[model samples]
Target: MIDVLYFAWVRERIGIPRETVTSEAATVMDLVDELRAREERYALAFADLSSLRVALDQELTEFDTPLEGVREVAFFPPMTGG
Candidate 1:
């Protein structure tokens, strides 16, 4: 199981801050494909991968990063300076 976290607008769109997902995905992108298949909210949230950033177990990483032994995955929009 992986703890999937959503921040900022991502949380708003999904209507939840986080969820625990049991997946067979080999990569972060594959995990996204699973979530996107679950519901329209997930589909909308992940529609534009370029606008989002991913962190695996609290360290920044890419969507293609392997999910082996990972415990957490977070998704959020890219940070910008004010």
Candidate 2:
């Protein structure tokens, strides 16, 4: 099981902060496809991939990154240096 974490507007849209999911996805994008197929909220939250940033096991990474032994996945909007 992978711990999925949603932050910022992602949490607001999904109506939850985190969830533990059991998936057969090989990559982050594949995992996203699973989530996007779960419900409309997930679809909306992940609609625009370019607007989001992902982290694997707390280290920022790309969507195509493999999820072989990842324990955690975080999704959130890009950070602004203000």
Assess each prediction's global lDDT (C-alpha) against the native: 0.97, 0.99
Model 2 scores a TM of 0.99
What is the clash count of model 2?
Answer: 0
Clashes in model 1: which pairs?
A: none
lDDT of 1 by residue, 1-82 (tens): 9999999999998999999999999999999999999999999999999999999999999999999999999999999999
**lDDT per residue (tens digit) for residues 23-46 in model 2:** 999999999999999999999999
Q: What's the lDDT of the predicted structure labeled candidate 1? A: 0.97
Off by over 4 Å in 2: none
